[model samples]
Target: MTAHQNGNISAEVSDFLLNCFARSPGWQLWLSLPLSLFLLLAMGANTTLLITIWLEASLHEPMYYLLSIITLLDLVLCLTVIPKVLAIFWFDLRSISFFACFLQMYIMNCFYAMESCTFMIMAYDLYVAICHPLRYTSIITEQFVIKAVIFILARNVLPILPIPILSAQLHYCGRNAIENCICTNMSVSRLSSDDVTINRLYQFIGGWIMLGSDLILIFLSYTFILRAVLKLKAEGAVAKALSTCGSHFILLLFFSTILLVFVFTLVAKKKVSSDVTVLLNVLHHVIPAALNPIIYGVRTQEIKQGIQRLFMKGW
Candidate 1:
């Protein structure tokens, strides 16, 4: 098996070297410091949030249970992508084996969909709590959350499992360098000698169908919540409702906006620098994970008190 002329890439290439920030070697150190900080913050904050919810028996409701699910997802997302990125930055360990890359791709693809679905159902929980106060207990019971968890798992895993399988089947004759820090479906598939039209179509169409539907459902849930909040007759009731929903709303905004920007830039790649595109993709995983617990902690009183109780017990 002779090496190809272009960079001498072999037909038997077994690993991919991530060309992260390849255009700006000087910036890798600069990026590494902040990335490391964010990873640490995300890990600490999410762990504390999970612990707070777990130990404080009072916090064990459908709402907190759902929050726990998202927190765990955030932790998993960070652990999956960030440490490997940090290795690339600090230790120059950019080579990811074919098996690991696809496994990472599968987790990356599947978890995000699960997170979106979780956010949609969470919005529904808020709606039921505010709109139908009397039936909230029955509608948003532990049983209801268990069912939602099952739905989230099934909805994402079955559809996304094919992504890596299809990607792995492509014949990579040469050019095994992935320009991004992560093993995105497109980044890996584009390296193949085979026609990747099916991969592109499945990724684009399937991703939109999953995320777009969740966004639409989330929008409707919040619309009803807003209407219900406005009709409240009690003084400060509106403020209280806004206060209750504000953190979740902020989280949703950051989640959706970052994802939208990444998708847009990814499609219109010519307009954006490749480094900028990769940077956004990296931050999309870290920024939201770091901020979700902090926003909820700052705005939600119950969470704030739970943290305090945990700290007091530790002290």
Candidate 2:
């Protein structure tokens, strides 16, 4: 009955929602297939990473020690949601149960925060090892990392619980189809007719604070690391330092992009083309998860040899 700007009658919110959900394009097939390939590869690579890191005592040193922990976290993180996320493309579950979506949101957010904390710890570890090599043993001890790891374990899960918990209380009397495949908090929020002011504010503030803090710390750490790497006169020593930090740098950038872009995009209402959305999800999860193992394996030669040794011995 109401006329719209284009001389068309204004459609109900529900109709718009249906259009967004149903308009998945043909090119999504391309996105979904490759993502599945990468996901499977990530699973296997992460398994090897876990086994190899635990088997070698040489890897138990402070530097490799932090690296091993990251491998484990990456495995847990990727496996926790990417499988279900991929499942959405195949299953036409246009609507997700409220509880299920909240659970997914909680899990995804928890890992996102955990990775942020991990990055900060990693930057500090490198700052000490490279910047203060003489005191590396004393400064970056096993005890220091253990405490930080414990704190991160507790801290990451604690903050995100609020958002999902609050969301579970909202009633949905209407449309529930998720536009994109995954069950992100934004999708759940869109379903609610009640005031989402609190949830939106929390997401914007909490998400940015976590991502900004980690990134700032990483920048500062690298500043000091670069200064130290430059002071080293030996080409061989400089190469070694660069090699170690280089992989971590690349991996950090990869993870940061995936986590930040996905979280930040929640506010945008424009329906992402199915292909683009799937591609975003794939690169966000698959490539980062797969690239992580490669970064660790290639940069740390010992890991490659250790994994080979492990396979040979098992045989």
Candidate 3:
């Protein structure tokens, strides 16, 4: 089935079938089991963390609030990609409407960018708290978070909104199978008969502008944080300070590393199987969602205590 754009000569496919993995269907059933477990863990862990933060008055600071936002974005990102993926894997429900595909593409782009921006903000939060101990409270206020959120939303959403729209305008000439689990902009655009150079170039430029800037800022913030931590004369104080920022740094490292691996896999596509690339892409979304909350709950003392309080009350 094809969709006709307004008086245009080119035809677009009305729906798409996701090329999930190897053509053999048996492996997918086994694959779905672990993916389902990850989704469940991601949802459960993030929800519990959100609730713990909500109930614990001490966890109501700007840092926790930013963490909560990250949890929310992670939840949304997982929900957007995983359910449909499970449906595709388990039930052979591979067909996705054109508009639905674009919507998924848009959400994935926007949320990933938002998550990157949030990490940058969190890095700044750590920097302020550690480097400017006296002014940390004044610098990382509720109003500052609100402004940062606004900036994040506007910065990411506005630039990414056009990507899916541009893809939708392309003539898809009956090539409707997406070679990945999620509706990535490039994956969808590649199906189009038109030259995807513009699409690829725009996304490349926009991604660097958004994620690149954030990564650079995050690196600088951590550099300052490390320098400040080293200046402390007391070993105990240095250890305590490092402990506070260590978890955030670790999660950030995981996020950046996986993403870099995915990019490298794409660049080295001739040597890597498409399955490996697709698997990496899928893991990129779910792994962080599953791990971020667990890391925070384990590392953040207040959150750990709040979780204990919650469990004790339940008991």
Candidate 4:
């Protein structure tokens, strides 16, 4: 046990060794290639989306502004987790400073919560557009988007801030080897000598309360939208409404599926390999980020035109 004291706190492990599929050393090369591709794809796609939105004045609206927020969140998540994982896989630089680990954990928790909130707000925007078309312009204004962004940050940061804080406060007097690629609350807290029942409970309960509520609200919004769309007697009205919400539905489905898969793998650890869980956890950070902008770009006509215009201008 290497004791390194920082300020008032004494720690046996000053840095954490990430055990990212270390048992199968040969697989690291194979894993590193795809991870690197994913990182590039995510960075490129999100950067393009942000630039396109910024350059195109016509695309400036509540929906696009909210999309920019989601894009930013995805960029943050990918940057927070993937680069370190790649370093671990490729260069075998697995040791992460104690402070860095906790910072990554905080970013993972807080930004994910913020993304969920942003999605819920986007759902509300859809609900307003579909269920009450007349009120949408008035309801989802520039001021409304600004307030929603404020709420998203405040709601997530305040609640999730305690998770890493609580985990970091624990005394780590034992092993510093984290079984996963990233510093998750459970993995980091479990390494501590202190009892982490509170940390686990708060992580579980707080996560559920935040995500669960968002899911429920999103569901309610879509339900109303579906009902309203079905009631439309005008020709192409149903198709138009469906088209309007389809991209968001697809993105939400992908996000929720990834989240569910991670949760399931975590719960079924006995049946699933630790390597698979870790891989899924790492992929969770990159895959959605890499795909979100693509999904939006393909689905939204304005974004496609904006991209075309951007290319033409550059050429």
Top of the candidates by lDDT: 1
Off by over 4 Å in 1: 1-7
- Over 154-177, each residue of candidate 3 has an lDDT whose tens digit, in order, gives 888888988888888888775677
- Write the residue-wise lDDT of candidate 1 on 204-273 in tens digits: 8998999999999999988999999989989999999988889889989877865676567768789767
TM-score, every prediction? 0.96, 0.86, 0.94, 0.95
Ranking by TM-score: 1, 4, 3, 2
User: What is the clash tally of candidate 2?
Assistant: 0
lDDT of 2 by residue, 147-214 (tens): 88898888877888888887666655444455665666666677667788888788768988887889
The prediction achieving the highest TM-score against the true structure is: 1
C-alpha RMSD between model 3 and the true structure: 3.1
lDDT of 2: 0.71
lDDT of 3 at 92: 76
The pairs that clash in candidate 2 are: none
Show where candidate 4 strays beyond 4 Å: 1-11
lDDT of 1: 0.88
- What is the Cα root-mean-square deviation between model 2 and the actual structure? 5.7
Which portions of model 3 miss their true places by more than 4 Å?
A: 2-11, 23-26
